[model samples]
Target: MPLNSFKSKDNNAKPNRRDSHESTTRRVGVNPTLCRYGGDCRTKGCTFTHVNPPKDGTTKTSDCKYDVNCTRLGCHFNHPNGRLIDQKMVSLPDANQQNTASSRVVSQSPHLEKRAHQRHQQLSESELIEIIDQFLSKVEEFDTNDQESNNSDNEQVLDILEQNALQELRLQKFEFQSAINHLTAEYNSILSSTTDKKYNLLQLRRIKQKLERELKHWESRLPIYARRSDIIEKLEKNQVLILKADTGSGKSTQTVQYICDAHFIDEKQIICTQPRKLAARSLAARVAEEYGCEIGEEVS
Candidate 1:
């Protein structure tokens, strides 16, 4: 019968262990197929077998197309059991087992055992102390490097803060300087304006003094101004005095001014009677011109 004849016609048929063993010939020391869940598989009807393979390599089996790397669930080729493969499907040895294996290998070889004994003697003396000192120095160097890096980062942060502070100070300084300049300009303008006002006042005082002198000179030329002291003395001695004077002799104008100057009475208190309104108006106009005042002020 052909090898292909052994293939089951029913796709869902349960696998027969006896037929599989007879057809492939049970390989001694070779493990059955590993279940997908390894030793942790709980399904009672699972098709793949889970078993530990012997470590002695005493079994012979046909190689798979993909060897240990095959991933197909229905593959019929041989693959390494979990114990002979990686730690994923099997528990790894602890530190004690590794040390026992190393010690065993060392004991099995005379050359390795002699070398290990020599190395042990060297470690009991100064060579082991030197190695410890070297490790300490390397650790200290790593710590120093980390500290220096932290210090550099702190310095950079401080520099950035200082720069920001300086910029703010500069901005404040500029604002203060601008305010001071504005106030200074205003003070200077007020001072110049006050100076101009003082100059104008001084010029007006000088002009007033000069005009007073000219006014006195023009009053000296008036005909009644010559007899001003005599008229004032006569009025002081008498309650009433009638003095006759020719027209245009300053009697209507200068007489009242002399009376007001001698008595120190307000100009509005004195009254003068005239025969014609035109003459009174003419006399008031002339008196105002001579008094250096407008018509309704000192004279009228």
Candidate 2:
């Protein structure tokens, strides 16, 4: 029975009864647009009651968007509902339950499970940057070597999981250093017994081929190469720096070896700047030969 249908004993006073009812009615305030269907609501058929919003923004209810499915105003997800404990996401049930007696039972959706899982995974800023740096560093290091061809002992790609992602950065650094050591050993094996410049050149080519894969990402972080002007110029142009002979004479045997001694910081890097692996390799071999032993043997 509706409240409006209540009957009174006085039959002749209908106009007075309605006026008395109107005087007792009160204006109520609610969430700006808290009108939503009571099907999913905590309360039924009453999103609000004659709600009036405060101007100074001191209102208790939200001024959110309309929740049209609601019995009152409707959905207002993006609304400013500070006091209202609203659901973050509203998903309709997958089952077609509108006409059935058990219309309340919604089908479970795989999409909802996936969304939950996705939200569970989150990476912090430090860990995120470290992962990026590690990847870029690997790209540089591998690009510098011929690991693609002489990969007798390549380390496994670290499993970067959400829980252990920080370990990946440290692990990759270790792996990077290990790879460099392997490459150095590979170079050593080729230079162990070669006296002839041709053999030296041949071995050097192999080394150069390996280094070519390392590419130009050498200083992706360190500024050592970037700060050196002469080295930078050579790296950019793929040119060799040649020191001319003195006075009007033909070049001495010592001129080449002298320069080879000056800039060849690491004997392995004698041709690091050379564009071609073969050229760098041959140069390394010749320098090693002129100095009295195979390259990389510490020719005294």
Tens digit of per-residue lDDT, candidate 1, span 1-300: 533346444577445433455444333223345433433445544445444222343333444433444333234445555212223223433324533322322233445544644454334323433443453354356447645764565434566545554444334334334433443354334434545654534333323322332234232333455455567788778878887864434577567766664554643377666786555655565454444344456432
lDDT of 2 by residue, 1-300 (tens): 443455434465243323344543222323343222211233432434322222242323433222222212123223443322123122334234332212221222335544543432243333433543454466566555634433543336534342243333234344335444555666556557557755555444434433332222132211222223334346447655553432212122223433343344444343234455544554555444334334456532
Q: Which of the numbered candidates is closest to the native, going by highest TM-score?
A: 1
C-alpha lDDT of residue 27 in model 1? 34
Residue 60 lDDT, candidate 1, scale 0-100:
37
Q: How big is the positional error of residue 196 in model 2, measured in Å on the Cα after superposition?
A: 3.9
lDDT of 2: 0.36
